[model samples]
Target: MEQSTTIEIKDNSFARQFETIIPEGLLTVEYSFQERKIFLTKINTPDEFQDEIFLDNLIRTILDNAIEQRLKVVPTYPRIVQFFKKNPQYKELLPPGIRI
Candidate 1:
């Protein structure tokens, strides 16, 4: 199995927008606002497994574009942090493992 990961931003909205840009089979992303972290898990089938360099570059490109677009709508870390803090209930949207 091949594996790779990156953390370029710390917001759920950005994470969601990021998902829309990537191919469905290429990756899976988990985001936690409270923890202020994002996890990108690469799901590589036996046939699709490739060199680490290729996967790394692809993920970087996807993340860079996604973050750029999302920032236009919701700019700055402080703004996102404050939004989540004010609406604590939004934390519930996160997966159980990431709720902390």
Candidate 2:
């Protein structure tokens, strides 16, 4: 059987964002209660691990994290937005009235 990947998410209140770390990279995203939106501010991935499937799974993991926290997000990266746009099943991950 294949082992499931483990992605860790840590809330850094000092930075007002969640820090997600996967074997291939790290992503920093900020959540604003007043704005009710999560902002993906930064991403760093090793070139060797930049496969589309890996990236899609990474983004899905992030969105799942946000859902578990009961928050909507505004993905700033064009790639992320495009990915969500292409995948309608993940539409609920977007903030209301906000289209990618």
Candidate 3:
């Protein structure tokens, strides 16, 4: 029998961050509101689960959450830019005017 993989994403209001939890571990993306800018800080994903497919899906999920909350995001992590650079198809998931 094949076991289903359950990935859960949550917004931690007190911490001002978004969290994605899976069997491997937790992934966190922090954000802050400054005037018209929404600063999306570090993205911490489990080292073991940093494969391309996983990273792509995870990033997409985070971006979707941000849109649902009507928040503009500025992804500060270099990896995010790298991911989009390598897979331009996913660039549509990003909001307008995001540097990366």
Candidate 4:
């Protein structure tokens, strides 16, 4: 199904997470920072909201933010690592000499 709704993500830096509120519930991408690298540690999505389009939009927003901030991404979460594997274009955001 086509997702007509725009995915809006809020970066709660104090909580070290990116959050979005949907009808289903709150979704979040938890993370930590070490120098230029942001370690994406976990992704929490409500069961009802766990669909491919929603997840991809969420991840894409995070990647876009990381790009704007010029921060290297370190996908510590297995799901995010898998995402980078599938979306090779995002691999350039990874720290040099690192592989998914």
Candidate 5:
């Protein structure tokens, strides 16, 4: 799973997900917001969009989005939980008492 050269993500509130359209298809992070928190529940990425850098950047971008909305993140998805574990700096975006 190699990544594209660039990515552009957008919030599709109607679908309750964040998405980026690429040549292969759509890369999406499914989510639900509640009580000032955003629960990252799932991710959909075609094989062609799967690269470490791309995944890192996508997760990082979502964290940045959470920061802008002043929302804490609850990573219910295993992949996002793993991401949080690997990137400690983003842990601050997690709610208090939450751990990867």
Candidate 6:
């Protein structure tokens, strides 16, 4: 059976910043201001080519690329270092199938 997963981002500000960088024609994303969360839904097509493995890989690639781009926008090394310090769990928090 195919399963869906939800990733919850605790930082509302980061969520807003993220939407700007996501590429078009990828997964469908919905944002909830009241809940302060972004919802991503995998678009499944009836075509036989659209299988579970394909959908999983597509989501992984898109999220990995988005995170990499966001890391580049960090203004300075000091800021990045400080961020990591405050959120030591960041290294562990990285999305599944992503390499830092």
Number of residue pairs clashing in candidate 4, backbone atoms closer than 3 angstroms, sequence gap of 3 or more or interchain: 0
Model 1 weakest 10-residue run by lDDT? 71-80
* Per-candidate local distance difference test: 0.39, 0.69, 0.67, 0.88, 0.87, 0.35
Clashes of 6: 0
On TM-score, the stronger of 4 and 6 is 4
Over the full model, what C-alpha lDDT does candidate 3 score relative to the true structure? Answer: 0.67
The C-alpha stretches of model 5 lying farther than 4 A from their native spots are 1-6
lDDT of 5 at 86: 85
User: lDDT tens digits, residues 1-100, model 2?
Assistant: 2233665668787877667665666655554444666777555565655566656666777788778888777777777787789777778877778876
> Model 4, 58-81: lDDT tens per residue?
888899889999999999899899
Kindly report which residue stretches of model 6 are placed more than 4 angstroms away from their true locations once superposed.
1-44, 47-50, 71-100
Q: For model 3, how many clashes?
A: 0
lDDT digits (tens) for residues 7-49 of candidate 6: 3322235433222122232233232222322223223233434
On TM-score, the leading prediction is: 4
Candidate 6 residue pairs in clash (backbone atoms < 3 Å): none
On residues 1-100, what C-alpha lDDT tens digit does candidate 1 reach at each position? 3344553433346545333223234333343332433433322223555554544444445445545544211122343334335545444433445433
Position 9, candidate 3: lDDT: 68
Count clashing residue pairs per candidate. 0, 0, 0, 0, 0, 0
Which of 1 and 2 is ahead in lDDT? 2
> Which lDDT value does model 4 have at 91?
94
Residue 56 deviation, candidate 4, in Å?
0.9
Order of candidate numbers by lDDT, starting with the best: 4, 5, 2, 3, 1, 6
Candidate that would win on lDDT: 4
Looking at model 4, the pairs that clash are none
In angstroms, the error of model 6 at 36 is: 13
